[model samples]
Structure formats: C-alpha cells, structure tokens
Target chain A: ETAVFQTPNYHVTQVGNEVSFNCKQTLGHDTMYWYKQDSKKLLKIMFSYNNKQLIVNETVPRRFSPQSSDKAHLNLRIKSVEPEDSAVYLCASSFLGGRATGQLYFGEGSKLTVL
Target chain B: QQQVRQSPQSLTVWEGETAILNCSYEDSTFDYFPWYWQFPRESPALLIAIRPVSNKKEDGRFTIFFNKREKKLSLHITDSQPGDSATYFCAASNNRIFFGDGTQLVVKP
Candidate 1:
C-alpha cells in the first residue's frame, strides 16, 4: 500500500494541553511536508523535511515542532495547544525527481479541536 | 502575504454544468502549478497540474488553463457531478509549494 498514513484521525483537547500527530509514507518519496488547514480552508505550510533533514520551516510558532525519523516518517508535536491551533493538520509527501515531480500524496489529515 | 490567490470562496452549480475556478500567483519564479481537490473529511489529492512551458493541460473532465505572462491559471471542471463537490486548492511551486485559500464547490444534483 503505497500511501501516506496519519494516526489519530481526530482529537479533542482543552487549552494548554499537549498533542502529537504521527505520519508515515510508503510511497518512497524524498520530501515530506506539514500543512495546516484552518476552518476557512486556508492551507498554510508549517514545515518540510527531506531525508530527515529540515529543509523549509515557515513562520510557525515555537510551540510547534516537526520530528522526522527517516524519509518515511514525520511527526508534529504541539507543546501547548491554543484555541486558534484547532485545525486539520495534513501530512503530504512528494518526489523531487523524474516525471512525477511536484505531485503531492496526502494522508487522511489529523483533525484537532481545542476546547 | 498570500503567494497564491483564489477567487469566489464558494460556488454552487447544477450537475452537468461547468464550474470554473480562478487562481493567480505573485511569484514568477514558480514553474509548476497544480490543483488539489479535497472532499469532505478527506485529505487533498492531486487532480490536475500544468507547467509554465505549456499553456494548458487536460485530464478527463478537468482542464487547467495557464497564463504565464499574467501569472494566472484557472481550472475548469466540465460536466460536473455531485461527487465533484469539494474544496479546490490552487498551488504554485518553486523551492516550496504555496497553496491558495481553497475555493469550495458544491454540485447540486
């Protein structure tokens, strides 16, 4: 099954709580990305990693951090959840070479709701 | 600042109609443009894509019209079905991809 996988399809927590989302890809892609989709459907990039090396880090808050164990695994951890942090966190992966360049395969995003 | 912009935050159309979604970008260095579609409670999937070298690309009922001179592109979903109802995201890529605030399309049967 060549696809991206995300655990905890949905989660609900109160403010000041900590949460973590895990992602893994079996498509053998080189790059993995985290995108935050707000209630308004605005997609914002949070971080990107290539081969376990940080490549692109957007203007996200310090409370948010991304951990990559290998090219296939990327995890997001929120130290202290805020009300505004409630959104669908999407994990995507892509290949940088060959004919299928720029094509992103996404996981079934992890939805977070802060109370 | 939004690097990629999309218009008509929401659109409602009848089945078998053509739904046109508009998009524009700010960066000229972006050579790749792709449209991703997300169904309710589902993650986004790549629907169609186009490069700057070509002004148009088509797959099935979806077509992407690109204007590199103006840094604008549009997606046309012809013969839209109720299953086509989803949020469409326009994205541009250089070193990293920038996605626009998606346009929600509702196809009524």
Candidate 2:
C-alpha cells in the first residue's frame, strides 16, 4: 500500500564494501529527497533532486552519492561503507511549488547495517 | 545548526485527552510549516500543515496553531487515542524543507 516504493528494505554488509538502495515514487512529484536517520532518530537531509537535476547536496561524506534517472526515481550508492554508516535511509518526494509549503511523501525506508 | 526545534522529546497522555506538541523555528523566511507523524517501523506521513498567512489550521482531530510573530507553532490532537501514539515532526521551509527532532507521544488507553 506504499505509494513510494523502496527495495532491499534491510541490508547488511561488511566495512569497505559497497551498497546501493533504490527508490521510486508514483505521486508525480517533481522533487525527491534522501534523508538519513541516525541511531539518535535525527533526520538529516543528504540530497535532493528536482526533475533529475541535483539541487540540494549536503556536506555528506565523499563515499555517499545519489543518482536520479528520472523524476520518479532516486537511488543512493555508498562506495565504501563504514560502521558509522549504519542507519535508515529514507526517500521522499514532494510537489514543487513556489508559493505553497511542500508536503513530503516518504517510503518505508531501507535500513543499512555495516559491520 | 538546527533551524527548527521541538519541545519535550517525549510525551504521554490518556485516551480522550488532548495532546499538545510545540515547535519553533529560527528562520523567518519559513512561511510553511508541516507536521508529520510516524509510527514504529513505518514511514512518516503528513498530519497537518499551515502557512504564515493563517494562524490556525484544523483537520478532523488534528489542528495546527501558528504564531508568525513568534515563529512558533503547536499541534493539538483532540480526543487522543492509543492509535494516535507516534513520533511527531515539525518541519519548515521556504524552498526546501527542514525537519525537527521528532517528539515521541505515548497515549495510554
């Protein structure tokens, strides 16, 4: 029943390994975002894409990268996973409007575990 | 560097009571405020939202009280039920949205 779909709901890998997560939205929202929820439950914006164009990219580690092939898809890839990289990565989409406040739609999230 | 903040990291209330959650932001340019709630092992969803033009917005049992002058707002859940227990987040944005530390609410039946 999720409008936003994510694959590999849970993943586990050793340090120095690579990992990837996929996300897709059906709401037709032009803007999508990637947020990381740490152990402390703090949600931080990592990246955002509007119509396949990178708009907001936070000061994330170099190992982390985001790819968007279309407006409905946004993917996250970690080149070299670290122990501290264990967290919930959430994909969200929102309608782009200049006058109105954006309301976000989110996926179930992919939980990453690095050893 | 937290622009939006929420008070009382956690709260508890009885069924049929009103639960209030408070939030404040530092950015005056943030005209839109949206409150989202997430249950355990689930994704967060929008509960209610408001703009600076209006001081209050209500939807069924959920309501958002906004104060543009103080840059503060509160979400009031009337007739709280156990099902209403979840983590509530306050967010603000002009172009892009920023989230606040969620407030965990526990409603006892």
Candidate 3:
C-alpha cells in the first residue's frame, strides 16, 4: 500500500536532453520533497514544497526545477540533463512543515541515467 | 560538514544474533531521531523513531537507544533474521530530517 507514486520506474536519456519525473501522493499531506540518492546510497534533499510554496532548495542547479500543480502533485524537471544527474530520484510526502514528527511516505523512486 | 555520521559502512551478522548499527549527530538542536530501512530498488521507509525525551524506544524486534547528551543513537535489532538484511539509515531533525550515509546490513542464515 504505497501512498506516494512515481512514474517511469527507470529512464535513460542523453546529455542536453530535458527530462521530467512525475510524483503524486494520496495521503493528503501538505508537504512534498525531492531527494537524490547517489551511487554510494547517500540521500540528499534537493527541494521541498509546502502548501505549493517552495522551500529548502539545497544549492541545486538552475536547470533543475520543481513544479506543483496542487498540493498532492509535485514534479521534477531537468532542463538539460548531465551525466552526473544519473541517480535515483525519490519523492516523499509528509504532513505539515514545521517539524517532522510523522514518518515521510516515499515512492519507490525513479532511476535516471544520463549518458 | 555532514550533520549525521553513521559507522561501519556495512555489517554482517549471523541469524538470531543481535546487530547494532551506530550513528552520531553534530546538531544539538535535533530533538527527533528516526531510523529508516531500504531494500534494493525500494524507497527508504521508517522502521522506528524516538524522541529526545526518551532514552529508548522499542517496537517488536527493533529498538532505538538515544543519548541526548552525547548527540548519538544506535539501533539494536534483536533476534536478527535474514529478512532484516537491508540498508539502515539514521536521521535527526529539529525542523527537517537530516539522514546519515546509511549502513548496509546482512544477516546470514
């Protein structure tokens, strides 16, 4: 019973190409986050959106952007994908934003490979 | 600087043996500590969590020992089984959850 969902279990693209990953949550959470996991399995928070407001941008490149159509949906778009962008993209959602008390429900993840 | 540091990049234990995964944090303001477990090709899921108010929390075979003074915590898996094999991450947060590099554990049957 996965509350969060991500499309395209895996994607392989070339450098300079634009890519988009879609994420949706049915838990009715107000906060959504995007995290990148490298080959070493280190998870880093890239961006977070609370009530459709952007927060917690961790020095991500301008090419990387997040779009939220509504609170339940947050999408990640890479304008020009680079080889270094090859990693696992995970989407998670939680309730509220002040402090994380409840667990964050995560999607399986979308694997991106840029050659 | 890494906010959280986890030890033994990887660990292996025999079935039925207790396995301990250690973690330390640099942020004193972190009042909440949670441990997440992830399997290959799956997203990390919260296994158990503990607040600084308590020194220990237990759920079934998983337990979290917290040291608020030392800014450290450890996860103890009692009666470890093969199904417990996975990467375990230790996270701390006052506002946002900050995760450690994670420890890959393997339980040999």
Which of the numbered candidates is closest to the native, going by highest lDDT? 3
Q: A94-115 in candidate 1: lDDT tens per residue?
A: 9862124668898999999999
- Candidate 2, residues A2-95, lDDT tens digits: the string is 8899988999999999999999999888998999998777899999998999999999999999999999999999999999999999999988
Kindly list the per-residue Cα lDDT of model 3 for residues B1-109, writing each as its tens digit. 9999998799999999999999999988887888999998789999999998899999999999998888889999999999999999998877787899999999999
lDDT of 2 at B88: 96
TM, every model: 0.95, 0.96, 0.97
Q: Write the per-residue lDDT of candidate 2 for residues B1-109, one digit (tens) a residue.
A: 7899998899999999999999999989887898999998888998889999899999999999999888899999999999999999999989989889999999999
Error of 1 at A100 (Å): 6.2
Alpha carbon deviation, residue A26, candidate 2 (Å): 1.8
lDDT per model vs. reference: 0.91, 0.92, 0.92
Worst 10 residues of 1 chain A by lDDT: A95-104
Off by over 4 Å in 3: A98-102
In candidate 1 the C-alpha lDDT for residue B108 amounts to 100
Q: What lDDT does candidate 3 reach at residue B103? A: 98
Worst 10 residues of 2 chain B by lDDT: B27-36
